[model samples]
Target chain A: MIRLLAKPVSAVWLLLMLATGLSWWLGLDQGMSSDQQSDYRYISSGLIIIAFIKVRIVIRYFMEVREAPLALKLICDAWLVLVSSAIIYLYCLGPVPVATGG
Target chain B: MTSADCFSAVERKVEIKPHVPGEVGVWVFILGDMLIFGLFFIVFVYYRGLNVELYSHSQATLNQNYGAINTLFLLASSWFVAMAVDDMRNKTVKLAPVFFPLAMLCGLGFGVVKIIEYREKISAGITITSNDFYMYYYIFTGLHFLHVLIGMGVLVFLWRRARFAATQADVRDGAVIEKDMVLIESGASYWHMVDLLWIVLFPLLYLLK
Candidate 1:
């Protein structure tokens, strides 16, 4: 089993699975009593980060983006990080403040 | 032209191979698809920002276990596809038949689990119209599920095509092996993209706080 996962491609699949489990546990923990419960930015950010990591692995290994040219690789890597980071940023911002029309 | 000159031209083409997966056109499509999905994700987060409490409450109702199961199957399917591609690259064409079907079966497992999850939600009086979060959940996941279905079709095509690689005819028809491989690689690439979408979707819908 260990040897199977040692292969670069298989290692990515194992890592992705482990990351899913870790994020599931993170989601289950509310981290505070009911009286003090609130949106946990730390947890949300962690989840988004895990998502980006998993996406990159999928693109690089499963999609064979690594075997492709550098251009495709950069496009994929950038898309994964940019969108997930944006999601996390907005998630941490609480609520969008509505602007009033003049 | 002399035979030596023709051979040299072929060698040059090999030396200067165009670096793209499956086909250059498919990569263009993949990038465009990712861009569209990225836009939707950004829009979702923006809306989520306006109604955090409602979104959070609805998110709490999601079954993380089902999402995790889907993730496992999708990843397994992708791994099998990758292995198939590797076998093809190594010229072990005989293995393509085994790997492609395994990949498809994993994909089938994911689809079954997703359908069951949707059924559970529907039977419990939850649905796309139930709330804002559920709406996004159904829309995104429903679209993803549709992609998986289409990907399964492509996998079936790949499986049928890969079978030729092992037959006696491929020994005579070299082009048959090459053509089938290109199709398999292209289909596998699309399947991986489906897995990538679900990778982000799982955390966004089920696991994130």
Candidate 2:
């Protein structure tokens, strides 16, 4: 099992698992003491960014796009940038920060 | 047996050829599916922006533990599939057969979790019509669950194929393994796509503040 975890794919798995835990913790309500609730918009934005980074890791490592041809790599990266940017853009464009109902 | 040693060992084994990881046709399908889901995410977010309170309130009603657990499930399933593909590529057929079923088991776990989540939501009287957020929640997750179901079938098919390839590996030249890899990689790529979509969907529906 130790040897298996040493393998590149397995190492990537560990990283993904760690990232998931971080995202879960970030999503939880621990840090939102009344004063910090307004800061959640930034936290929310950061969460979206972290989510996309995880997606890219899955694409490159798990899906083996790292060894793929340039064209395929470009297409995948393009999709990532476009979708992530668009979501963040629209998310911030909203009329106000999300109300925490504190 | 250090991590660096293992990394270099696998690195040396896999030739760094710049080719598609699977069948070209499958990628076409995968990319097209991604495009559609991308549009779905954008549309959902646009509408949510129009009414943050409604969406966020309904989102709070969701059991986020289920979503996070399911994300881990799909990530694990993808990892198993990746290991299987790597084993097959290295001609270490012994683990390939085992890894495929392990992956399927993870898929099964995802299905079970999803069903329980749906049941919980329904029992709470939060059907699709409960609100726009629930509407997108049910539809997006339902569609993804369908993909998981199909991916489970694909995993079964790949498991059988991996078992067959393992049995045949000793009798034939390396050419046989190479031939089997195309199909294995194609199926594995599809499975990874399923995982990737949920990676994006999880935060969009469950975690985003």
Candidate 3:
């Protein structure tokens, strides 16, 4: 049992759990009842960024991609950057007005 | 061997070979799956961007607790599988078989919570057709649930394999044969992919502000 916990994956698992908790807490509405419109773009962006970081950790550790060849590692990192940036860009762009009276 | 000794032994064994954990084809499939899901995420966010108010309001109705709990379940399941893989590599097949079942139990826990969440939403008349958000919710989660089901079967198969390895007295050091390592790693990687996708999906659908 000690040996199991001694493995680096155990540390990775602990980090993943704590990161999940952080995301969960960040997702909660923190009792901001002001009538003024609040900009949550930054918070939402942070949330997604954290999510992607967690995904990278899982890929590198749980998926054992850390030990993989350079090509595989590059591909995975490329996907992470591409998707994460796209989502954040679109999210921060805010709502586009719908075309009506077609 | 003591835990410290085991740790150093692992450290010393690390070679310069560029090791892929699973077979090449398995990674091809895993990467393909990830690419599709990445597109799914982009599509969802694109639509959500067109009407942030609608998505946020719909997201408000979702029970964050259920999402959080399910995230924990899958994370724990992945950890168990990782440990199991390590055990097999380290020639500790006796304890490895035990981890697979525990991992499956966590997977089962995810399914149950998901069902309950679905029940709650359905009881409240929030079906997929109710809104765009719920539509994506059902489709994404339903698809992921299918992956979980398949992963459960994979875990069962791995457990059987581990058990067989344990029973083989002729096998030196209780380690799985080299030929079987590829298959084991492949299945394990697939399971981890399921968990990885959920880590993103949870926040995108349930917690995105």
Candidate 4:
């Protein structure tokens, strides 16, 4: 396993899996009653962070953007940062942060 | 073109910047796709912000295990695709032919799993009309599912081309290999985008609170 993780790609994959687990843990309170759960923003921030890390990993390692020219890498990296920030900002704009379905 | 060879030659002599992967056009498409999906993410979050309770309650009704399994499927497939690219880079062209198909199989498996999950949801009378959250869930996952199908099509094309290139590599010069390398790189990049979208979607739709 250590030998496997030595590869940058494999390391990214492992981190992605671990991040997935973290997100899962963050939402495990789904099974608990209402009082047991923390607020959405608190849990979602962690999820968004992991989401950012995972996207960067996929772009850098899997997509081979790490070895690419500066311009290409910058564009992809910018997308990773900005879009996630926008989502988080939108998600935090209001108190309830979600609307009921019609 | 001896682009790959030229890069190596330049590296052996002087230090210059490496070239972009594949064609610039493909990267343009990837960028466009990212913007489109980014818009979707913003829109989903915007809607979710309006009524957190309904969204959270509807989210709870989802089966996290299904989403988790689908995520594993995509991640495993991505590893396979990455390995295929690595195999080609190492001049182990034969290995790419094998790995590419394995990656496709994994992608196909994800579709199968997603279909099953969709069926279960529909049978439970949960659907786009079920709730505000369900509407977004179906729309987002449905659009993503469409991308997966398109990706698989692209993968098939790449597999065929790469396999042919491998055979040509046995007889032709290294340029053949380099030509196919860029193609493989481009296709794999697109496929990774699909996986990347799911990475965020899984947590937001299924795992996060």
Give each model a TM-score: 0.86, 0.93, 0.91, 0.87
Best by TM-score: 2
Candidate 4 on A1-84: residue-level lDDT in tens?
365457889877878877777777775765655443446667778788888888888888888788898998889878888898
**What lDDT does model 4 reach?**
0.79
Model 2 per-residue lDDT tens digits across residues B41-74: 9999899999988998999888888889999999
Query: Over the stretch A39-63, how does candidate 2's per-residue lDDT look in tens digits?
Result: 8788789889988999899999988
Off by over 4 Å in 4: A1-6, A30-36, A96-102, B1-17
Q: What share of the true interface contacts does each candidate keep?
A: 0.82, 0.78, 0.92, 0.65
Which residue pairs does candidate 3 place in steric collision?
none
- Give residue A82's lDDT in candidate 1 (0 to 100): 87
Clashing pairs in 2: none
Cα lDDT, model 3, residue B156: 94
Worst 10 residues of 1 chain B by lDDT: B9-18
Compute the interface RMSD for each candidate structure: 1.7, 0.8, 1.0, 1.7
lDDT of 1 by residue, A2-101 (tens): 6545779997788888998888788785567553344456667878888888888888778777777888887787887788878877877764222224
lDDT per residue for candidate 4 within B50-81, as digits (tens), equals 88778878887888878877887888889888
Alpha carbon lDDT at B182, candidate 2: 79
Cα lDDT for residue B199, candidate 1: 81
Model 3, runs deviating above 4 Å: A35-39, A96-102, B1-16, B169-176
